[model samples]
Target: MSLKKLETLSTKLLLKNPYWEYKLDNYTLPGGQTGEYHYVHTPGAAMVIPVHDDGTLVLVKQFRYLWKKESMEFACGGVKDGDFLSTAKNELSEEAQLAARDLRQVGEFNPFNGATDEICRVYLATGLSKATRERDASEEFEVLRMSVAEFEDLAGKGTIWDGMTLAGWMLARRSVSALLKEKRL
Candidate 1:
C-alpha cells in the first residue's frame, strides 16, 4: 500500500528566525485523510557529550529566555549551514571552549518527534584541550564539570530536565556502554 502526502494543501509560517521556522505542513494522509503537521523547520542540530579522559563530563548552564531561568544542559546547538561533525566541533569550542581529538558520532534522534522534525546528532567527545572561546550575541551560559555517575544521578533525580541534554545523553551513553561491554573503554 502506498500512503503519501498527495499535495501541500497550504504552508503557513508562524515565525521566521535565522535558525528555525515555526510552520504548518498541511497534506493528505495515507488513508486519504486531511492532516497537518505543525513543526519547527530547522537546519537541524548537534550535541556533544564532552567526556574527559577520566569520564567526567563538561556541562553548561544557560539562561533561556523562554524558561526565564538558568537551565542546565549539555553543550549543544543548531547546525547552522554546516555538516554535523563540523557543527559538533564548533559547538564544542563555542559552548565549553574545548576541542576534542576523539569526536565519535554516537547516534541521531528527533528531539520532539510529535511536534518537530528536528533531528539532533549526538557525539561522544574525548581527548579534550582548551580552545579560544567566542559567544554568539544572544548566548549566555556557564560551564560545569562532573562525573558520568554524578550526571546519571542528577538525571535520575530530575535535575536534568532539558530535553536535548537528556536525549543526547541517552544516545551517547548507549554507545559508551557498548564500548565498555566490548572492553574497548
Candidate 2:
C-alpha cells in the first residue's frame, strides 16, 4: 500500500531563536484524521571529517550542556546564509583550528528527521593546515587527533554519541579508509 502524505493546514511558531525555531504544524491525514505535530525548523547544518596528512582524523571534545558530559564530534555547525561549504569551512576552523586545501562533499543526511527539519551535509576534508581558532563565547573545545580505527572503536563503544558525528562518519568511512590505506603505503 502506498503511504499518504500529511497535508499541512497551518503552522504556528511556538518559539524562535537565533539557531532554530520551534513550530507546531497542524495537518490532516488522507484518511480524514487530523493531528498536530511539533518540530524544530532549522536552516540545516554541515559537518566535516578532517583527515591529516598522516591519515589521523581531527575531532573535538566539547561539553554538551544537554547531555551534561563531554562529547567527541567532527567539526560541524548550522548553515549560515544557506551556504553549506562556507559553514563547513568556518566550523572546521573554529572548532578544530584546521583548514583543508581540498574539501569535497561526501553526503548529506537528516540527523533527526522525526523531530527536526535538519539536513546535515557531510564533507571529507584533506590537505590540512593549521589555523587560528576563534570559538563562540559559549563554546570551548579540546582538539584531538586520532586514527580511524581509534575513532571507530570509541564510536562502537558508545563514547562518540553525537548523531551528526556518527552520520558524518558513516558517510565518509569508505573514503577515509581508502585514504588511510594509501597513506600507510
Candidate 3:
C-alpha cells in the first residue's frame, strides 16, 4: 500500500523558533482517514564530537530545561537555513570554544521521527584549538575533556544518556580511529 497525503486541511503554527517551528496540521491519511498531526518543522541540527590527538574527547555538562536535569552531551546546535557544515563549525566554537583542524561529517539521523522533522548531522572533529566561547544569556554549560576510554566506560554504564551524543559517538569512534591511523598515531 502506498501512503498519500491528499491535502492539508489546515496548518496552524503553534510556536515559532529560529531553528524550528511547532505546528498542528490536519490532513487526509493514506487509508482515507482524516486526522490531525502535530510535529516540529525544523531546519535540522548539527553535532560535533571533538577529539584531541591523544584520544581525549570533549563533552559538555548542560541543564536541559525540558528534562529539568543536567545532561552530558557533545556540543550541538541547530543548522541555519541549509548550511549544515557552517552551523557545525559555529556550534563547535560557540559551545566549546574550540575549532577543528580536521572536520568531516560522520553520520546523520532523525532525532525524533514520529513527532518532529529535525535531523541531526554528526561530525568528527580533530586537531583542535581554543577559541572564544560565546554563550547566549539563557545558555549555561560546562566543558570538560576525558580520555576516549573513559568515555566508552561512562557510556557503557549508562552515564552519558543523551541519545544524540550516543549517535554521534557511534559514528565518530570508527572515524576517529581511522584519523589516528592516518596521522600514524
Candidate 4:
C-alpha cells in the first residue's frame, strides 16, 4: 500500500507564548481517517559553531530547567523575524561572548520534527574575537573552549548531549576539518 500525506482540516491554538505556540491540528489521514495532532509552532532557531584560530570550539555550559541538569552546547538561539544569520551572531555573542569575522552557514535541520515545526540553521563561525555585549539577564552560562579532539571525546562519552549541538556539529564538522586542513580558518 502507498502512503499519502495528511491534509490539515483545521488548526486550533491551544496556547501561545513568546517562544512558541501550542497547536491542535485536525487532519485527515491518507487512510481517510480523521485525527487530532498536537504540536508546537515556532519561528525557528539558529546555532553557531564558533571555532577559534587554534581549531578549538567555543561552547557554553548552562543549566536546562526542563532537564534539571547542566548541558554543554554550541551557541544557539531562536531566530527573530526570520533573520537567521543575525540571530546566529547575536547568540554567539550572547552565549559565548565571542564575535566572528567570518560566519558561513553550514546547514539546517529540524531538531524535533515529530513534535514541533522548528527548523534550526547551523553556522560555522571563524576568525573569532572576544565580544563585549552584555549577557541576557535571564541567561546564565559558562563559556568553555576546548580542542576538537577533546570535544569529540566528551561527545563520544555522552558528556555533551544537546540535540541541537550534536545536529549542528554533524552538519559542520566536515567543513571545519576541511578549513583546518587548508589553513583557511
lDDT on C-alpha atoms for all candidate structures: 0.85, 0.93, 0.87, 0.93
List pairs with backbone clashes in candidate 3. Answer: none
Give the true-structure RMSD of model 4.
1.5
The weakest ten consecutive residues by lDDT in model 1 span 176-185
How far in Å is the alpha carbon of 162 misplaced in model 2? Answer: 1.5
Q: Residue 137's C-alpha lDDT in candidate 3? A: 86
Tens digits of per-residue lDDT, candidate 4, 76-150, equal 998878999999999999999999999999999999989999999999999999896788888898999998899
Which residue runs of candidate 4 sit more than 4 Å off their true CA positions?
none
Give lDDT tens digits, candidate 3, residues 146-182: 9777888988998888988988888788988777678
Task: Determine which window of 10 residues in candidate 4 has minimal summed lDDT.
Answer: 176-185
TM-score of each: 0.86, 0.96, 0.88, 0.96
TM-score of 4: 0.96
RMSD of each: 2.7, 1.1, 2.2, 1.5
Clash count, one per candidate: 0, 0, 0, 0
Angstrom error at residue 164, model 1: 1.1
Q: How far is 146's C-alpha from truth in model 4 (Å)?
A: 0.7
Residue-pair clash count for candidate 2: 0
Candidate order by decreasing TM-score: 2, 4, 3, 1
